[model samples]
Target: MTRSDDESRRVYATQGLIDLLLERAAAADPARENVVLDATPAGEFDADLGVDPATPVLTHFYLPAGRAVSDVFGVDLGTPAGRGRARFLTHPQGPAELTRRDDLAGVVLLAVPPWGTETLTAFDRQGRRLPLTVLDAEPPVESLPE
Candidate 1:
């Protein structure tokens, strides 16, 4: 298969997994409908993440609560300027607008680049950052031929 084909399949599978998780969450708690996660991009998908001053770093992370991700990014603990460059991902659909019976789960595009990300954080409805549990992916031993 072509590289584009592989990428398309990857995107489809990732979205399917997210849908399954949302379904399961809804089944467990009927009141969890229309759950707005803080891991969504607050504005345009192509918004500059400000990771680098010379170049724009764009990333949209839609991390599910209590789930392990395949990608990992380290926080810039050595640089004090990193804290000022932090960008938060918040759901576009405000929580106050959602009703108890709205089962519409927010659609998240998970096609994110792993580079230029200094820090990652998720927040609750009360604006408290929740601890994230990440599962780092093993590095590939070889690269695919172009």
Candidate 2:
């Protein structure tokens, strides 16, 4: 598929993921807090991430990482979708980026705590989990691709 086609798919997947998690949160406990991650430009990710900027990156990583990350909202409910909806747009399993990149300690994404502790647990393809910081919204960036 073309780059634009791929981007469109990723955007859909990211939005769908947010909607699903929020919906689930409203169901399990409407009063409960939920997280909404912001999918920003690839260039913005370069600054926040410790990984080598040379590695080709996508606008969204966590979502396309795999189903394992899809269910990040499952943290409180104890149920992960096991496959991220964006999995089709990117990698088959594990993180969208290389599992072990010298510049990266792990994947990085903008955390959005629409309501929550501002912290969430996400797992990689190997089932290895890590605590990712969830922000109130995505950080500002200078250049964004159209």
Candidate 3:
């Protein structure tokens, strides 16, 4: 069966989550940076995810360095039945204080109206959602040097 607009939106959100996870993992640790998108298990499907009923998408990003690091942020996205759920995990020690005047820590979440469009969301270590303004339109720059 063809996917619905809601289904497509959820898929887009989930994929965006996966991308963010990978980017963070790579920045936090180069060696342990990896992302896995697994098909949802038969009985583990949640109606709130907003995706296809037959296929549940589970994305996981492994960051070995982040295991013990404080002041870190973890994000996950899941889609079931065309709705998207975004989650943010913060380190116990909280985010590090900014030593530089230009330093900033924040998250941005965007949802396209009318459904079936790509949704964008971001978060900081504090699990707060940042506003998406025209100034934030530029794509994220690489955190690590090539």
lDDT string for model 2 (2-95, tens) is 7554433222113334344544444544232223233444334424443233322322323223345547743423223442222211122223
What does the lDDT read for residue 136 in candidate 3?
10
Residue 114, candidate 3: Cα error in Å is 27
As a whole number from 0 to 100, the lDDT of residue 49 in candidate 2 is 44
Predicted structure 3: clash tally: 16
Clashing pairs in 1: none
Q: Candidate 3 versus the native: TM-score?
A: 0.24
Error of 2 at 8 (Å): 27
- Which candidate has the top score in lDDT? 2
* Candidate number with greatest TM-score: 2
lDDT of 3 at 129: 41
Off by over 4 Å in 1: 1-117, 137-146
- Per-residue error for 51 in candidate 1, Å, reads 32
Q: What is the clash tally of candidate 2?
A: 8
Tens-digit per-residue lDDT, 69-142, candidate 1: 21333432232332222222222233423233332222222111121112223333333333332212221133
Compute each candidate's TM-score over C-alphas: 0.19, 0.26, 0.24
Candidate 2 stretches with Cα past 4 Å from truth are 1-23, 28-38, 42-119, 138-146
